[model samples]
Target: MNKKTSSFLWNLRQLNLNICPFGSSSIRRMMKGDHLELQKPKITYQNSILKNLLLLQSLQKPLLSVRFFCQGVLVFQLEGSEIQKRRLNTLTSASVGKLLYPRQLSSDSQCFFMSDTTPHLAVDGPKKMMVPLEHDLSQKEKQLDFVKHRHLIKHCNSMSDVLDIFSKFPRFSSCNYFISMWKIAKNMSEDQKRFERQLLYEHPAFNQLCDQVMKEAKTVKLQQVIFTLYALIKIGIPQNTYLVQVLLRVVQERINECDETCLSVLSRTLEAMGKSKNVDALRAGLRLLVDKQIWTLEHILTLQTMMKCIGKDAPYPLKKKIEIKALKELDKFSPVNSQHMFGALAALNHRSVILLNECSKMVAADIHGCPFWMLMSILQSCRDLQYQNLDLFTAIADYVTTTFDMWKMKQVLALLLVFESLRFRHIGLMNLFLKRVVDISQSLNQKEILCILHIYSSLNHICDSENQQFLEAITSALNTYLPKMSSFSLLKAVYCFCVLNHFPQEPFNQLFQENIINELLTSGTESERTEYMLHQVNACLELEGTSVLKSTAITLRECSSAPFRSHVDIEEMLLNLLENKRLFLKNVQLPHNYFVDFELRMDSKRSKVFPVSEADAFIAEPDIIRVALLCVSRSAFCFGTTHPRGGLGIKMRHLKALGFHVILVNTWEIKKLDMSLAVTFLKNKIFSQEAFPTAPGFAA
Candidate 1:
């Protein structure tokens, strides 16, 4: 027999079918012919037992001997002579109850007896009975019990049952069935309410529920309306949707009826939406709440929202009241609340030692638990306030090292900026961050990629191998993104590369080509174009040690009437001097103040007259010729202009008094003077004669 048939017979024997009214002769008839064939294999144990009992009741043949016991299968022997005994001996070993019968049964009288729990049955054969072991049975039984428990949770009768089951197995709380049931639950405990909030925010079904609630927005209760809107905002729903408008109208209609909590919620919702038709009502509601001394964490949040929404439009008195109240209740603020409070204070440019210290303590206590964006905001607030706390920076660096993978792209960039702003350095952390940036560089836009490069270049330290690797990755990807870069980003990229002294030639040429510089100069505002041109000239000189693009020079010269006229003049003159062989020197300092346009030193030496210790004896000392180019402004040389002496007279007198030759070139005069005339002017000042003749009274 197969294992299935053996299991069935084993179960039947355990059921003690002999206790029934059926005799051994009936049992023999039941086992005869096709009755066993009528029973299909692999039937369940219960069905097998019932079918066997029914067959026994229908038995027609009688038996000579019949024996029944409580624990084993039934056995019968026929009343006939040797024919019956020989027939029984001819029975196959494949019979269902062959294992249950003992071989010692009397054979001469053609009789046998079957009894339950026969000890001699074991000696017949050990492998014939395929009973399962205790361990396997217990394992299967436990699996069956767990399946039943899951079924109960899935088709729970009520919300109370779901809550009970969830309490027992908190893991099941993530189930969709539980989430749906919890949404419609009428009553819940504090813990249940907190769980519901978490589910409503995280569950995928939340938006569908939001759509439903918003569709029936007019009928939703005030409390439900507030919570539904709050949840939607938390989930980042756009505030300008039609549903948002409906919700806003609902809140506006019920504004007067709302208590402090409801008012705070409405204010925050409106603030998040960044719009409100009834500012007066919101301001008044807040004022009344404050007058009633109903300060809470919600009040602080509402105040923050108001500051953000109204900005400078917020009334002075209302702002003052909110600030005072928030300060008074600073002790009760949580980390999240403190973040908002600090953000609001920073926005208004308000600073307080107590508030800042408290915020620092909260953040230091649980830096890892803080949200990435919140941490960024706190860092930003500190930056804006120029507040520095060593403990806070240490905590932030620790958290970033442990949980950087949890940060988003923008957060990572912002954190880097904070580090740069504070001049904080953690070489290992920065190196790891740069590697991550390079890994994700392909996915970043031109602006984002440039930002990373900019941060790296802006650091005050020297470039290491990791920094060089980051640069290589950026330049390799530069061609793909360079075409889409804005002019500002393009300029910044070039500037960064030049700052690092790691210029990539192809991108540099592409970015600073003649057409691009012309477009920038012609299209940008005077200040912007001037700045770009200046940076282009500086970058080219630093990287290539050559003049700027010809088109850039022409643009600068043609835009003479531009706002940065003097600055443009200075740059052109400096570039020209840099390129000229006669004027080029071992050292040159660019103009930094109103007095000097450019300071140049040549290899020529000269002698200067000096007095020895007031003895009135003259002596000559050798000195290098220091020539200062004073680019005279048009206003300074105008006919009506006044000077202590004459026009350009007092400045020349000062230069002569300082024992140095000064060259005064009129702005108009320099515009007319080309490279040779400029070179001639410089040679005269340095070798032949002073460009400015001394006044009669001045000693020289």
Candidate 2:
């Protein structure tokens, strides 16, 4: 308790304070460990920086790092490139033990929970946890791969060259490159965009790619190189279209090397050109290589393929113009060059009027290069387009008639076109055209004669009363042709006669009486000989006089007894004609018959009529006389000809005219004829005594 004790105690207490609450050794050891622990974070920070730098170096960019500590103890480290690491470093403090950059690459900043006081490097201390950096790293990797693969990098060569390389691989071998190329191509300007996309076709780079695959790779699989180019072209390349055009030209130059395999590839590629921005360029290439003079059949076929691609979607006027130009070049082909001819025809099928007009010019030029078959091909094309243009038809008609000497078949087609044109409102031209045909036929042989007759019959369907003049014209033509020509002339005559008689029905009997028909029926060539006989019968049946039918029946009946009867199919045709005649008779009510019915004007009240002369009357005993009159009454009950009443009337009238008395008897006259008593009275009066009815009480 003394001063000395207090001083000693204070010094001891001070010494104890310096030492520690426990032992000095334990305190010193703890401080050393704390120092090591504090230094540990610096080592971690340096290592992390080095590791992050390595990662960033690999990425070729600067990066930032964030260090985290709990109560001055190192806990975790976050590292990222300068993109966000430096930003993260701004808010987080290493001294605070919680260091986080406010702008972090990942949502999660490097964070540390503090249990003891430690200086904060971050301005706003700590914050909500951010998303993991691992996610960010993964995302960046993917972006890198995509950018690398999805775009046409600067190192990439010309699309054509690239396509050529791809062509060495199998189909779809360059899919990755193709996809990349396509995306890049689509990104190009509107002009380049077209061909680029086309290049991306299944045969990628097809336009640019030399189709000549490596000789070593020749044995590779189907669609290998070709399909690769196809794909590349389809997905497309932006700057490669010119290269594409070049490639196409190269292929076209070496087109002979194309087999079906190559041709098939070319066909597909050309089809894609329809929508290509470089269509004109591609077409130019085709034209340049596939010139008309040296064009092979394959080239024509390729041209056809090109046409099909554009034909439908192309504007009609534009397509028509193109067709005109194409056909002009096509027409230079030789007739024997059937391949060109067929191709030209197929192409012209889409442009009928143009073809027809061109054909007319060729015909007018007296150019014999276009063979009959070729001209026929052109005319055949017109059929599909016939209704759209009449000038084409008229020109064709003129050509047919003018060129008939050169191509008979074309004439037939021309006539057909004319006939069709005439079917609607163009009869003048049709008649003129047909007349020319008829006139020409008459000058030609029987074959040509038959052709005209058939043509006339074909046109006869539209004939009416107004066109009856032409019918006579036709008849005249036939008469001239049939008599002049032999062989089938009889057949022609029969055909004409039947047509004229059934069709015109206008006074052909005069021609019939010329007796050429009778002469032919008697003797004509074996061909149509029976048909000639049938014609005579048909003509007679068609005549106004029944005498013709009587004569015809007798003639045919007599002919049946002859040698030719067994050779003819007479009964079948005759019966057919007879049935036709019967039908005609049923429909045709004669003027005389009309006079008897609706036109007849006898007095209504008169039951009996006086004949023109008394000689028309007849007398008889009462019963017999009554019967006669009843017969007359029955006959006077006129109606349709089918009625029997008229039959009896004619008979009674004849008898009456032959001096027989005929009392008029009808329903009303039945009673007047006589009751039994009157009959008895009449009998006694007429018979008198004895052998008669014993005087009915007037004495025997």
Candidate 3:
């Protein structure tokens, strides 16, 4: 290296490690090439970013580049000024090309691949003869409509701000518009990427762009074509099959011509394809192309993108191949990038604990530094594996509760669901959700409303003022949406009410209408949940003074039961209690297809067992207590917590409304008990007080 350049690099390396905490190994390896090579450094795309910094140091540079952005090797930011931001923007546009700077800005959390060598795929294949690049295409692109509308497009903040501009795309303007708008959109924060992509997908010009790109496929510049495909995906793809095939063909035809820069964008586009889960686009073989080209990729951005693309859908052999590659480049896999690999691994339906632990360590090591999205993914990874890490979850809870406002609605839903799956709860987060949900309740989609109903109901949220408002909003929204909701969804909505111990009379009135009831009965046969709801809804309605909604189409006895049973020992012990204390029937299936551990009818004061065949026959007699011995195993709970799952709670509620004095024989509490203790435990559950305990509030 020349003395001047060598001294500059030496100074960069000698910066205080305690302050920056970034390793320069990649930088050193990149810079070790001869000065001639240093002029055009062979570092991967991520390093190319740093190389831009090396050159742009002549313009201006910030210390540690604003919180040590190590390019997926455990880095974050401190928010630089507008000048530094502009300087960084220039550095990015100049480095990764214009199409990418925005995507890179969209979310730092995305998995990227990087190959130091940047090899083209299938070297042994014969190279095709190169066609001379079209001269007319370049000249025409300069005068495209985007150049004319550049001033107006620059001031466009949201996608709506540019709908008029998008509609005004002249005959030959799509390529420039696609390229320029993507660059402009790059300036949007990461969250807006999802929204704007949807808007662009809905625009008429998107179709025009697709047709235009297909017509110009052979003549347009390769980067323009590749980046346009990437942008089409970011905005969201229309259901256009031909467009995917045409783009796939262009990519295949241009495979050998792709350099590292081209491959970086290509790999990224493939990553988006995988994430978007466009079956047609993937079937177009761009996914297979990435698989074929996997060995050639060494860059972290490219590799992570490859892992992200493979996800769980890739076959076992390919997953193993990429897994080995990930392990080999483990250092390059940051907590965020490692998350993609973890997601892929978990999707295999196998828990790779070693990898799960490794990922946990990365996040735990810098839990405070992890972004909202990254923590959510880690929780998801834990959820998929059924892995429990209290420390990690606690750290995440601490961070998320304080910054609760930062989460998007769907992300918040996912996080809460993950927390439920993990059996972890944070009061602050729950309160925040309840409060936040009420504000946005009016705007939720049908699926989202159902999800909210499930979330709050399953969590067994107390009906505080905030929660009541949220539930009221949800139910009101459902009532408004009833005309549009499918018959099955109406059943689900009613079931959510039953789970919460209420009759959804308003919706139920509409639901019991002849046509909708028939629709639900016919369509509901295929689903276990639907079948359960059919019986439970009717039972709940009747117990609430409404008439039965069951029609001839419904067969109470013919409904499918889960066939799941409790442990044999637990069942035996519970039978012993019923036999020893009271005359009782063992293993009775209720009218609702619910299997009771033991069913024994008693007078209302529970002084003695009765021989009534049907428990409710004596319901009018205040002296009757319909005892249903429910053996609730740990599996029936929310996995790790003592709280019964929603289904269990629902069953208890149904039993209560049937005039049954529900007594829960917790499997865990009696697991270590002898027969005498088990009998005592059973007796206590029945005669504990005047009002028998229902649900998990059973005798201690």
Candidate 4:
């Protein structure tokens, strides 16, 4: 049984039969022998019971002349002449074992016959009646034919069957036929489209047929199904406008139940549509996907393709509208919701010329933080192009200025650094950026002051003698801000100072006064102390060379009443200064522990070191003779050691004492000088070697 039939039977079994009809097969043969025979099989469950009842009714028709066969049994014995006399064949039997045809049973089954002896005997029986009905079997055949047509379409296995059905109907004439075909096409395997396309590509006739079906057809569902399928074909181009319009109409008509696949199809079709440069189709396709909330992978991918197609082709007004709409839509989804936003950004870049204005507004508003990083990356990436638009630049600059206004020092400094790095691109903007950095540095946050200082450090690299005025202006500004700032800020200031060490001493000495250096020493944490100490040492070493140490001792004499220890102990302070200086030398390769004192006993390792600048001359150059004489003078006055060359222990002192500008010379240049006699005097005649016993404090 069919599923529907079985289900119907299960529902019908609970009801009792009421006025069911029955008929005999011989009467059916007599009725149908002169009429059209029922072609279908009989409905067996009820047919056999109806047939037997008719036969019984016919057999009882001649029982009108009844006689008693037993005490309680009635026997009907009627001859043909008697039956004709009372019309017994025409009368229906009201008793059992009587034959009745369908029409004959209804006419006589209700008639009552009175027997003369039976009236005296008083025979009575229950009432029985039969009603005849007419049946039209053609309605059943029509219903079966409809069902059979549907079943055939459903199980169609070959293309010939589909083509035959298609040929049987006029183009778009039979709605039901087309609807059925649509359902079938929807159920067709995905490969069917590829197959159809292959057919179209390999066979010109099929292509024409598909085009007619897609473009000029009146069948709406069929049109959409064919158009979407054709789009899926990956073959020759079809009419993009028709496909997009149909899909969009279908999506809108079926609102609240739109298929995601339809949205996806519309999206993929955009690539092909874009090749036509059909802006209408592009807009419609985007609107449909947005409407359906189907920002699927295909949708994003298609957007990327659409972006590439329309690169600079976007008109200003339309571009503005698209920007507003896209941002609003993206805001709805939150750009952070997915990484697809990166793709979206990439698309935006293609339309950047027109988008830059709207983008600037969005960025200036700063309501959405997600796109800021993206915008920054875009600016950096696009820097190489000469045509890099200024809308983006002005937007970023305006954003940084606003950040400065809002006291977002960290953000301002970050922007300043980016601008400074990109100064080579827009060279004219360098001064403006520097001025802004100077402004930010005035109120810079402790966390961000180092970054600003780093920007200055980079700026120094860019500044030449031609731009010396600007560099001097910046240096003067740093001098004012350095003392009151925190330790990290001071370290950053010192770093900036070291980077721009070419400045003259008057302004430099003003920077090194008690307040500035003390601020560095007192406010700086351990790490900052170490860092700045290294910065100072490297700068002073490069600037003064060996004479830096002698200047330190002379500076110590100015601090005479502060404290004094044995002159032999002065080396500790000197070592501390040199170690810290060595830490600041940039890119200089030195041995491990070359600057560290492994024997120092302080809990804080820095306590064993000192600022070499404090114990030596801060000079303009290295002079070997001047440094040697000064070293001799310091050893004679301070250490009083019996060495051949007086104070020869001071190696770099004589170099700077003779007014040498060491900045013009490198360390190796000074090293190759002829100092062999001086070296022997210092190593051998400078002192009588004495070895001590191995006790902690009792060496004699």
Candidate 5:
């Protein structure tokens, strides 16, 4: 018996067969027969598996039946996008694969849902994606012919078989033959891929079939055209060919007929040819298709395609639709796909906590097999969304630690950027990264070294005896590239050095020269950001870099724009409560051009709030405590965690540096409490004896 037949029998033996149609040779014949089949082979186990119900509904074929077991159901469809889903719970080795006959998905297909645990189709053909049964007899006869051809196509397992199938039905089965060939090629080992590439690269018949596929692009189904295009690119077919040009014109004419999957295919096809303008056009075309096709993401491939189409700049409403649709199919998402979805959404600067947290669960569970790039993307997303799941980070760190030898410096730098931006620290990962980076310090580029210095400057970058070696290695690398950098970048690098208290001797002369100082103050690129960096650099020098730049006085002008007002519920309520007491000052400008959420001057003895900026000279008294309420939103903290992000840390540090007592007001928490209780919470937090120490300009 074949493995499918054997597994089917073992599954029958594990469950009661009285109610199952498989008591006969039905499932067995379905496994090995020529008729269309969707088989999910079940495993045999020691414990007895339960089967309280086994329902089998026969369709046209004697052996063909839609089967479901109490303990077994389909977790995913095996055939077309229209097939229904059934659950096979606790089935460890579950994969849905099918030998589909040539025919459109019939009206019998259903969208599976459940009232309780047992998976079932509540309704059939809800979206009408299936073919109608009202076609004439000749059409059905044509379908029968297609099915026979598809059966022959299924037996194809090698590149030679692909050639035979293409020659037999070059018009009808060309798409399937291309897909089959790619499947065979992808599963091959390195030697196999090399041999196959040699076997097919210059074959005379391959060129004829390539011309056939390009000709078929005009009248064939748009779906087949796209599939053949993508598959041809994946195979050894030269990308810069007339075939791609012909298909490109055809696709442009039929752009509206393209679905989400086709859009993604066009994206990949154009990407392969380096036809970026066409890819951008396809991205622009998405705005029209999104509304109608957004809800049709039923398969993993479809979802991934939709994700690529959505990309970073899709509108928020469209992104929200993708998020909701993704959430429904979340259980079916593979680990890499899940992280890819997260990365796509996060890149748009849109975040869904439910989605982020769910994907994190999947990533943490599948740590060992997850790719380092996917892990880095998740970290970047988490950092973008201000979500820090330590469990996920720890799992990724362990995974990277195991696979450290395979990582490139660019990927390691990306990890450090995420860690630095998120204000996260991993002692072990850091050590591994430091050692690797130090060993390759000679090969480091200007951008890479600046990234390292910035990370160290934001993190625990105290230059102690133990840290001396790492700091020196980074500084040594920076010294080589500093002279080549622009004035703006050089200024930022020195600011980071001053923050770390690691003054390299080479760049100081170039950084403080009159010409460089003028360029730093007046450079047009990133002017506002450059001004802010200069302001901080001036402060860093006043506190730390005093020995140098004594003769050169850097101008400190406030480029601080008016911060957008937050209308969040907690902040509004807090502002109202304090406004009635005449003590809440909105948008109070602090000493170093830092704008606060609200400033409250209160009596230390009586805990009474008062306004000191007014004519009241009571502000001069030492009994008053100046409190700056930093109303932080939910996004300000790490996603799903309570830790504040790196940006918030900087704001708090700057507030404290200006001698204003900083209080981080978590709006998400206080927004839940009643007004009376919230007042009590605020009072206790503001007046309690506990005090957070004044942090350094760049706290390690």
Candidate 6:
């Protein structure tokens, strides 16, 4: 065979060995025998033959002979006749034979063949054809001989051959050979390039190639250095290795000499290698380029790389210069560069409404092609900058809704989190997202489950249909994934349920068990632990109609002395007293539009004692007391100005007008009251004559 045919056959052999499901042993056995064999030429084997026939046809070679055996009995053969030759030609031309006679070949039958001769057949029919033994052996021999004489370099043409040669003869290989082979490979098809990359690390000379590149580090051309570094990274070399460090030093030394394109390549190479300490050297190089006025869109991309590598540690001046230059070129920014620019700005926490508007316009124009990650980056930047552009968010939501099914779990969670952070919710988008979560619910991790639940609960409105299905799916997933959840995640989950006023029986029981609750409470900061414990207690109270553990209630009451009780903690304490019947009242009103907190009735005797005339309807009924628990900051009331309608003053007026003996208890004051003290305060308000002391002049 000519060199081209030989190379084709060699590649075919390699592909067959790598991809064939039956393994190389089958191919090896076929090559060793004078005739090929298929023990039970099933449809699958027939399909394999038909697929290989395409490769064989490219060789323009003719089949010589064919044989079929059934249980060692020669059931059919085609040979030594023009009619048989015509049959062979016809069979080769007819690609649909396997489909036509898929199961016609007996399970006991075996097909075999020999090349370079005419077919001899006892019967005339099409069947699965095996590879010719001679051709297979000849190809095998050529491969062996090629390996044996690979050091001579004459047998090497493709990148694979070069790799094989280098693998066997690295000590004798020249740097020129390595460079030339990579250059040749660079021009090959993507598949060939991918195959070569896979072979690169397995090649015996991989380490030697790295060593040679390092040894000639200073002498290699800039392109050679770039190509070498690119290849090393593609081959999975460690970025922090001494070899990479030496290579980086070489690149840095020659960086000033590089043109814009070369500098771009160098920057990307450093990025691909994840080198951050080289930021100073790279920044210096970029400054040289900048001074030379060699900047371009590529430089902007490289700037993003630098930002990612250096993070906030990048000097303010360098970042500002890059930002100014990048913004000036905003109109010229592609979708990809725009993404990087936004990401860089977010990394530095830089904010510019003008730049944001420019980015917004660009993103709006190219939102169709914007990838999931790019959308995430834009949203993240919006959040970091606290820039709320509804138009931009709407466009992203539109894209995500259309492509919701294509998203992975992480992407879905990230998109949901960004939406939640921005407080941007779209019903269609949320429904699609929830459906995806349901489909992949079994695969979701604890963190992802918590994030989804958080997003749902955080939204101001979630349609009941989606909410029910979503909660059900999460409840099912919690059964399987709860044990794997971290204590922090579990706590968040409880809080999420409490926020939504949802607590599935099984998950809540598992979640609020004594040990799990105790573990959760002990692991977080004092505030976080207290908040989580309160959520658990509230969820249990809402879903199970009882206190959590007595210990949990006591712990919450003790921790409630933090001098800043949260709204939930305050509610939990009040509910605990009510559930225990420590502070009894015949009539109680839950929170409503007029009453800010709980309303309770005092004893009848106390009511008669504090009675007022019916003309002054503003006076609260002697039997009634309305409680308002205010968690406002001390500053809120300091200036005698409260927030408009939701403020304490407005609430106090509304409650007093509704005939309530309004008692305002600040959270700071309530936090100082234990269970006994809190009950005492309530009882004192109820029965004490001074508690309802006739408003300003009424008799007691």
Residue lDDT tens for model 2, 1-700: 2653455445444434432446667655665674212211121223232233222222221113222211123233333322322112222333322222121212222322222221243212221112333454455444433333333345354344345445543232233444445444545676676654455454554533323232212233334444434544665433345444444434433444544455445556655654454544444444433333223343444444545433344445545554555575654533333223333435434545544455444444543444555545544544444423345444444655555555544455454644433332234444555545444543555455455445444334333543455555555555554434443354444444444333333223333443654565566456254643453434335343244333433233222221211211222222232222221111112211110100110112211222222212332222222112221232233221212232233333333433333333233233354345434433332232444233222101
- Per-model clash counts, in order, read 2, 55, 21, 45, 7, 8
Q: What TM-score does each of the candidates earn?
A: 0.45, 0.24, 0.51, 0.25, 0.57, 0.52
Could you tell me which 10 consecutive residues in candidate 5 have the lowest summed lDDT? Answer: 93-102
Ranked by lDDT, the better of candidates 4 and 5 is: 5
- The lDDT leader among the candidates is 5
The sequence of per-residue lDDT tens digits that candidate 6 reaches over residues 82-195 is 112212323321322332233432221123222322224411212234435335435434443443333334656665567656665453323444545655565678787777
| Cα lDDT for residue 153, candidate 2 | 48
Best by TM-score: 5
In order, the Cα lDDT scores of the candidates are 0.52, 0.38, 0.60, 0.37, 0.61, 0.55
Residue-by-residue lDDT tens digits, candidate 3, 79-109: 3211111112222213333223323422121
Give the range of the ten consecutive residues with the poorest summed lDDT in model 2. Answer: 594-603
lDDT of 5 by residue, 1-700 (tens): 2654555555454443433325546756655662212232332221111111111211111222223332243332324423345665432211111111111222111222121232244124221212232232234444334434345456766676667655655544355667667767767787876777676655556776766565456556798888877777777566556666566656766778986667677656654554355555655665557656767746766555556555666777877777788888887888777667666666556778888888888888987877667777788778777777778888887777778888777877788688777666666677778887768888888888888878766664443444777778877888887657889779878767765656666776778778887876766788877777677666655544557554444666666675756746655566545555355766777655668877777666434566555515766778777788887787666444555554455566656666678887777788889887886666566655442222112111
lDDT of 1 by residue, 316-352 (tens): 6656766677778776677777767667767656565
Candidate 2 off by > 4 Å: 1-256, 259-375, 382-426, 433-442, 461-489, 502-540, 543-550, 553-700
Off by over 4 Å in 1: 1-257, 291-312, 346-353, 383-391, 402-411, 418-428, 435-445, 465-467, 483-488, 525-530, 533-536, 539-555, 558-700
- Ordered from best to worst lDDT, the candidate numbers read 5, 3, 6, 1, 2, 4
Instruction: Residues 1-700, candidate 4: write the lDDT tens digits.
Output: 2653444343223211111124446545654663222222232323332342322322232222222111122222223212111322232223321222222122112222222222222133211111121121233233234433365467554333444554433232222333344345555676884564354345433333444443323223433553444333333334554544443443343433434444444444443444443445444545544534523333333443444333344545544544454554543442232223334444444344333444444543543343446555545544422224444566556544444445344444555566555542223343455555555444544445456446555444343433465455555556565446554445455545445443333334444556555655455367444543444434354544345232431121111121222222223332332333332222221121112111111111112221234224422322111111111222122112222121121222222332321111112222343454324332232112331121112101
Which candidate, 3 or 5, has the higher TM-score? 5
Span of 10 residues, lowest total lDDT, candidate 4 = 596-605
